[model samples]
Target chain A: MSRYLAAVVLLAGLAHPAVGAAQAAQNATLRRAQQAYDNLEYRQVLTLARAALRERLTGAERARAYELLGFTYGAMDSILKAVDAFKQVVLLDPERQLDPNRVSPKAYSAFDVALRQVLLVRQLRVDSVSFVGGQGAVPVRFTVTQPARVVARAIGSGATVVIDSGAWNGQVNLRWPARLPGGDPVPAGTYTLVVDARLGQNTFSASQPIRVSHGRVDTLPSVTSLPGYQFLPETEIPPQSWRPVGLAFLYTGGALVGTLGLESSSLGSSSKRELGLVGGAALVTGFVMMLRKPAARPAQANILYNHLLRDQIARRNQDIAKENVARRQQVQVTVAPVSPVTPK
Target chain B: MTRAALGPLLLALALRPAAGQLVAVGPQFVLADYREVASGLRYRGNGFGGALWARRNRFSVEAAVVRLSFDPVAGSAADSGFTATQVDAWVAYDVAAYASIEVGVLHRSVDPEFDAQSVGALRVGARSFYQIGPGATVVFRANYLAAPKFSGGGHAAVSLDLGLGLDVRLAGRLHGTATYAFNRMNRRTNPGGTGEIDAPIQETVARLGLALGF
Candidate 1:
């Protein structure tokens, strides 16, 4: 009888009937915070959840409450503050074992965890790009931990606006095609590109400066003593270009033989008069040279022409003697007679 | 693409001691029509050819070749090769980068219709050469012909076929060609005088053609 009475007294002492009231108060606070959070009233919800947690409330519900507060701050553009709240959630649960269906372990649990790594974008600086290049408007974009819309601008032009799918940072960037719709090329100068973004109510901005160099990609800058052209010696020559050399020599040799034979033949003038044969062995040779299978022989001819052009000029000068003589004769004979040789 | 492309152009630039070259679409195309062999009348014809030359931004050379068949109206199937043949070649100087006048070999049997014939390289872009170069071509060339074989050398006189030619490509690979020629042909007779002639009938030819480069 004594032991039973002692047991009943101990049970009464150990049991605190007011504990249920405390728990009910905590549950009601959480429900209110969640309601405020769903309404996007982040500040109020954060305040409520923080107060409830401070009042000795613990467990997954508290963890979720902290997470909702982080989201609220994040949506409010208080990024650092949001990050801090999420960090606390991680530490509290160590292994991050939170009931996903209820809320989230991390204060900022994103839809895509694969993209959880924080993005710290550095400014894009164009050391130097040629203004004469075919493409314009080089694209430079950045991704951050949250949704953002970036506006890039140059010093003279208004911002080149771009909208990125903020969550995953996926975007379609456009650069000026070889020709712009406006028919004008972007000017060359020290240009500045500025990016402004406002995504999920949070805003961010950055600016990058670049210089537009004036010159052709293949042209050489006149440095003190170097050749005035940049050359990446052609790594490959089409079989059509070099192949003409061999065939040209062969055909040219044959042409030389035919030309010599026809030139030396007794059929020179008489044959020319009777048969109108003025050295016409060029057909076969030309055909052969041309049919040079259309691959490389023409290349040989151009090469030959380029190299021998100087000699050809000299030859042309020599050949012009006949024209000069004809002109002089026409002038002296006709003009002198018509003018009566006035003061000779 | 498809070799179905009408004209193929080759541009050559910068030559080494061995030769280095660059090609632009020079209007040039070669087309051969083989007689169905059953026409009982075999008419084989080859025509349309061109070439463009460059040492890059500095100098250029252009040329073309043309051949047309005369109806074979005068003989049997055996005379198809000898019935009527005309060819021309030429070169031009880039007096200005956009235009050139070529003075080369001209076949008397082709191209002399004067204004009616498109011998100017500028004609290359008109689909005249069936589409040659894609962007730009400038050509200049001259012509010269050799001994012409008339009647397969069967007691037929081998005569001189002289010519002056011109071709130009106003754009990348398109080109127009023309030829003024003095051609002479001799009738043939078998070795035993089956049918022979001592000299050939001489005629002048003026021909015009087109070429395209791919």
Candidate 2:
């Protein structure tokens, strides 16, 4: 039974997109670590983001994606993954060594300072929301992306909330309507938004989202908040497929041009000259034919279904390349390697 | 009200601000022009685009003009630059989002300039209309017309006019319009410019002007 159980589990995992699923799982884990960093849970963000790096990525995209991942960890006071992700980005593009965009001494010093704070916070043992402060008994709200309940209570005399976490990296917020009429209502003081959820319990909880500064903005009748923004999903692009595609096209076009220029049956000097002439014509014709054919669609949908632009296609040919990729998941070869660089 | 057409228009009208509609009026500028080496010239055109509404903005009235002008350029020097003009109007009221029981003296005959057979294009008019509704605004319209307007006898005559108009906005501020008219005469290929003895005229002229807010 145990053997069958293991086999069943393995089969189930494989039946799904085993590799893509694993990569996606790793992505989700790193994202949560980023969330932890945003919540100022430095230690947890580092551990989680590091565990995510175990998955495979096809190319430089992985390196760059992880670079940002490391930054989040570092900002939350995790030093190691910050160094690792940044190093990977630089490795992906060795030009980073000479590139001014890649700062070395400054980033290293900043990481060191953050790492020291992680220790200082660990020693202090005081739960705190780092980037918020205001006055009066402030009502709070949480727009949590995950399913977890959070409870908050004033801890210190000035109204602070002590965060408890079985998982060091957790997000939670305290929420309520704008005002509480009774006298025992929340008083004016500095407060911390904390999380208290078990490790491995992937749900998110919120103790508070924003700290109250003054009742002025909150009490305004016509105040409206801007809509929250999130990044579109990252799509995987296959590497080095264009070179072979171009080569195949070039060979095909050359053959056509040769057919147009010369009579293949003749072996005389006249035939040789004729061959070059017809070959040139054949190539030109082939080039024209290529241009006449509709362009290929981008492999990834780049389709944000809910977005208006995704639905608005003023032209019909936009979907061709996508359809072609679907029909023939074939090899790609580039005949001419054209770089984005241009000479001044 | 057909279930297909009535549903969208009503939905659009309902979402708008329910404000007391206001009245509107403006001079119709008609511009028509045609060039020819032929001597006796004639031109005819009449059209206008403007609207008025009652309180609540649910009601509206739109109008246009019909005009024609001609002159014997080859014969009488006094009749060379002759001109004439005409105007007509159309109006409608809100029946529902899907359907509006609208009627006008001279209303929009070609509904959808894009797809001629327009569905319930629950769309708003130009800025001049009462923009109470956050409706589907289809303000900038480019209508192309090419057809014969007046023709009789053995010789064929044709006319064409392209006009642009603005609808009422939510605030009921300003409305704008521009009209261009044209006409052509075809006399069975007389290569020698001297064959025309009759004086039936064909000509073209245009008017360019705009309506402003107070």
Candidate 3:
């Protein structure tokens, strides 16, 4: 009996060590999953956590495994699977809560969505925008998990104005009447849409960019048409003058007077009178005609108008180009719930 | 007076319109001198005339007619003088803007009651103009006149004349013109014979007028 007891003791000691090594290998899989998660190896965490949950595990160990699965799925953008994993964690340990700081709000919100599967909340996004007068109001659509105080703020450069706010529930569509709180038409430019939904102590917010656009966004001050007279260029030739003709006639009369004087000594009274009359009349007529001159007429003014018109057309094209760039640079943003929610 | 008549007819032909044409008409006064060598008589006269001139591109036409009565010196008989009528017509080709060559005719006749002489001649002439202003021009003309014999014992006469003229614009299409001319004529009587046939005469005339154009 002593010899048989000694052999069994030695065999039991060896079996105990072998059994510990097998259990240690199983525990190491869970530990390795946690280390992979910490190292941000999400694919490895998904594989190790799934394998650990398939095996027999304590409640705490199972909850930890599901937590790892939740974060891994969330990192991979599989929100439904993440929600399912987190919900399993809650079902396993009702007293445990997810640390808000450690996970993103998206993950927390998804978890809340799974917790309250009866009421679904969707992501906020712009629904539509209209630019015509009386239809300028922008519509924002969103679905809520429950009734909540929803506030939409339109933020602009140094100017924050609440565009819409009210108590609302279910799939709600809000209209931001295209005006500031001061009842002024919104100036054309860029703006930000901030949607805040508050239910009990929980508050959620979303930010989106919005813009207002119009064909005539800028005020074009009245452009006066160019004056016709200003564009006329000076001509090289001076206007016609009749002064030389008058001077010539005057000189001719002087010569005639001198001729009559030379002929007076030899002429009879009648002859002398005839010469005097002819020469005197010529002198008088010349003096009179010398004073008369015609007025100069103006040149054609339309030539200048043609040049100015071309320049004005070019400027107008540039103005149109500037307006086009301004219009295209505008982006209209509307914020509302766009994605449909489903329980995983 | 066939040549005299033809002068006006050719002038009328040169009136054919081309790119541009000018027409002028005017009242005129003429101072005339008359001398007779055989009689040793001298006279002076005054007359009135109408002048017409037209130009079409490089061509031109002109016509004038004057009537005058000469007065004798003191102690001279009333029958020693005569009343005369003169007509002139011409056609010219402008070789340049300011120069032209012309052909014309002149007819000078006395009233039968005055028992005076009648003469007809064909004329060839050259004229030059200097433009001083718009519508103002100074003119110089020289010509030779070939006169045919019309009386028994009379031979053909040749005459030369130098004329100075002025064209003064009064207003639109209205103008005044004045001219002074010196003429010398030589006549032969009884060709191939001689009996005081080489008669030379000198005449001077001054004219003033106003013209209208269309």
Candidate 4:
């Protein structure tokens, strides 16, 4: 049993050094109380802690004194007295926590009981977010120690905007659109998000500082082309062939045949000089053309396709232009949590 | 027609300021062969002419006038030569990328009033054209002559004209053109109200020219 008691003292010593080192005691009696608790002198710790509570001390030191007494009574197996002392400890510093893994179960149970007996708001958080005005919301969350009437607000220099009000307990979540009653976004400035919880006459409030900023909403750029579709060449060069000469021969032959068939018997035969001159010229031109590079002719299919693609791009750009116009009128709202400052 | 009469007409057509209209005008050197009445009556000649072509959209108009002095060929019955003035005009509408339907008029008048037959006819025709090379095209046409009139007072039941043409763009705003035309008229006539006798006429002409494009 003595060994078990020593182990308990060791665990208690490991758990509390962090809290003791976090804040130095201003009062000599409170410092002695903390040293007696660390040394596992339960009787002396209780006496010094109670005497330190009677002296002039800072709020943190007074809470530490009560916490020392709570641990001493728990070690002495006086559970009821330990719970009472823990209640005083929590009432002074509602946010104080004892690690269950490091502290004796009796002491941790007493601290838990003290927390349930008080009305408090804890772990209030406002996450940083950015969105277009009137389109999104800010997320706020907190924990209530007991069932209470809770009210959340964002108080700025020029305005106090109520975020929410409810009878809530345990973990609570809320979304604040941050807009005015007339549907405009609230003015941009530094704000304090405060959550207050009340149970009968007992009330606790927690606050987080945040900054809201305004900026221009980004606009979309106009499109010059469509994805996966492209313009094609409107003209093409055909391959060189004897088609020109062949066609010339065909036309010349037809004229010759017609002239021979239509000549009158009485008129005998018509002179061939005119036909010879023109047909020879036609044949020579055809041969020369056949040797030359072919002309670029309209590629009908590609021309039609390019026309349609241009129309599509024009239509898409028109839509982007209209969307950018709408975006220009909307505001960008940025809400970021700032480092908290101590409240007076 | 005189050069003075044809000059202003071609000038006016070339100078017309109409949007989307293509116009070309030029002078032509022509070679012609004429045969009439009997095989012994044949003539050959060379002449000069002017031509104008204008097109807007699918419609086009072309006109050519030539004045020729034809002397009888060797061993022909004709003893003298004659001057003939011929005018041809056509208005065409494209029916396909390479084809068009056309209506036109052909009129020819003989000098000295009697050396050769002067004829007038309405032409109904269709032409097919193809682009053979860069700035080069070839055309062929067939026309039926209808309601023909002759200065010698003959009626022809069958008359037809066939043509072949080529145009090549030699340089900017300049083009080389050549055309061949062959026409035949099967005329029947009787002197002093006698029975009809077959008196046929045939002519062939080739025109080559350089044209300015606008």
Report the backbone clash tally of model 3.
Answer: 10
How much lDDT does each candidate structure score?
0.38, 0.34, 0.62, 0.86
Cα error, residue A47 of model 2, in Å, equals 61
Worst 10 residues of 3 chain A by lDDT: A262-271
Error of 1 at A186 (Å): 2.3
Scored by lDDT, the top model is 4
Which candidate leads the pack in DockQ? 4
User: Which one wins on TM-score?
Assistant: 4
- Give the lDDT of residue A124 in candidate 4: 79
Candidate 3 Cα outliers beyond 4 Å, as residue runs:
A1-344, B1-21, B26-29, B75-78, B113-115, B131-136, B147-158, B169-174, B190-193
Residue B44 in candidate 3, Cα distance off native in Å: 2.8
Task: Provide the lDDT at A16 for model 4.
Answer: 71
Q: Flag the better candidate by DockQ, 1 or 3.
A: 3
Q: In order, what fnat does every candidate score?
A: 0.00, 0.00, 0.06, 0.79
Reference-based TM-score, model 2 = 0.21
Q: By summed lDDT, which 10 consecutive residues of candidate 4 chain B come out lowest?
A: B12-21
Candidates in order, TM-scores: namely: 0.20, 0.21, 0.40, 0.73
lDDT of 1 by residue, A134-247 (tens): 434454444443455555455534223232233335332434222223543444444455455556555545455554434433322222222342322222233323222333
Error of 2 at B28 (Å): 2.3
List, residue by residue over A233-342, the lDDT tens digit for candidate 4: 99998999999899888888888998898888788888788888888878888899899898888999999999999999899989888988988998899999997523
lDDT against true structure, model 1: 0.38
lDDT of 2 by residue, A190-249 (tens): 443433332234332223223333222221122122235333443433342333224324
